[model samples]
Target chain A: MSTERGLFDLTCADFGLIRGITESWDHLLSRSIAAVREQFIEQCGLIAQAEALPRIAGRILGLMVFDGKDYSFSEIAEELQISRGSVSSSVSLLTAMGVIERTAKPGDRQDYFRLSEDPYTTFFARARNRAERAHKTIQETRDAVPKDKREIRSRLKEYETFYATLIKALDSGT
Target chain B: MSTERGLFDLTCADFGLIRGITESWDHLLSRSIAAVREQFIEQCGLIAQAEALPRIAGRILGLMVFDGKDYSFSEIAEELQISRGSVSSSVSLLTAMGVIERTAKPGDRQDYFRLSEDPYTTFFARARNRAERAHKTIQETRDAVPKDKREIRSRLKEYETFYATLIKALDSGT
Candidate 1:
């Protein structure tokens, strides 16, 4: 009976500690702002998944881009409620993609990350590259066709024109 | 021994029939054209998957777009070597998305599918709609932020402007 009482008391103390931590976090970041941030981050994650990228990478991007501030590596893991390992790999991926960049504060040894300058331009340039590749594929297909197949050649030409126009539009817009 | 011999003859006869069918198909559609069409269709399927659309639907679109002609439901299934049910469902999906359309010949009882007259325009319009949605999401997020958080609001406004510019570019190009 004494041991059972002691266990119950310990559970109560742990619950109180958890509540205290949550309350402090809520005080630092308002509940409304947290909710908004979560929604925005989820949306960006969905967008990234649609592009065949990792959802966590997109969420990391959302955090930095929406906050418009650099976050230390540990802070990112803690604030996003994700594993440090996940944060590390995703940061590397975003860095390699040129979507985000890493920096350091003068006295701080920990790495910091922020959205890259002109990420939208980089994204559009990637689109242009994909369009160019498609254009080249279509052109090669056209070349492989015999000269006698006029109908097929003409159709392939039309596809080439379409991709060329799309590339030009991306170029001008970017 | 006679039974084994009979099976061997049947196998040879089947092989000859298969070769003959292949030769006729090659005559009707040259081997080179077939190879090019397959590559183009596969590429379209990849693009469709990237956009979160059904890959088979994209292949159907590629066939019609590349050939610049309508295909009957049965023809679509046979040419793409997919099941009839898959073709039917994907056709419905593409029709709903306004990426492809169905038509009927004067004497034909079957459904024929073709690329919409302005499919690229439709595609761009869909992109603009997505941009608009992202913009709205950002705006709502911004509204939820407290007035004291000026920095977050400013960053969200920048995102809104980026999406707005994108929408405008898509509008003008389309």
Candidate 2:
């Protein structure tokens, strides 16, 4: 009976050891995931800055894209470690640009936000619109030039062509 | 003989009056040209700022595109009314981007510059390159995720698609 009891105790001990190891492994995996999330968010901010956008806006986008979940205004601020004011402004800007949309959750009074259904298309469309406006401006400038000045008129034509091509490319892509 | 001499003097006076009128008209026309050039350059600067590029760089491009003539470094500085140092840096940036090229004028040591051959294509190509790099980054981020994280992976895939479409459109247009 004594021998049997000892064997049982040893088995329990081994199980405890195994459980501890498994728990630690789970903890490490979660930590690694968190680290990757942080790094990815930072990278998004950097990329946005490279494109001359506000880094905070990019980070907000990163969180939405990576987590694949909606976040409340305060949640975004807390997750990004930014001020609520900045969050308000950035959220407004993103919404205005049609890159993100607001949502309502059951039993929640505050608004939540998520990436729009087709933000990429909206973004490209905006780019195309800007290019069209630029093309119009160039055309007007060209028209203002006297017809006798062939050289200047031709040069302006090149600018018009550049904007036209850009707009067409954006239109087709979107 | 006296009457004939008086008539000859009157004719000379009329010629002087007509020459003065022509000179003033030329002055006004040149001023209008200068104003249009200034407005165009300013527009270029604004457009550059919109794209997150330096205004001076855009102005330089505007000058080159509008004038359709090569300009010396000092001439660019003088014409734009910017500091020589600014012109130097902006010129370097433009050259590096392949939008402008330097040339040597015979019997003159100073370097002259003009728009690159097909600068529009080069500009679009650079944009496409940026989109490709962004797509690659998104792909790398997606790969880092474990296979089980299907949702995150799919979100990143959308980003990849956006860049791919943009690149393809740019390629087709250019």
Which prediction has the highest TM-score against the true structure?
Answer: 2
TM-score of 2: 0.81
The residue pairs that clash in candidate 2, if any, are: none
TM-scores for chain A, candidates in order? 0.76, 0.78
Model 1 has a DockQ score of: 0.24
- Write candidate 1's Cα lDDT for B119-152 as tens digits: 6666666667777887887877787788888888
Candidate 2 chain B superposition, TM-score: 0.78
List, for all models, the DockQ compared with the true complex. Answer: 0.24, 0.32
Instruction: Give the per-residue lDDT digits (tens) of candidate 1, residues A33-56.
Output: 777788889988877776567899
Residue A18 lDDT (model 1):
89
Q: Which 10 successive residues of model 2 chain B have the least lDDT summed?
A: B1-10
Worst 10 residues of 1 chain A by lDDT: A1-10
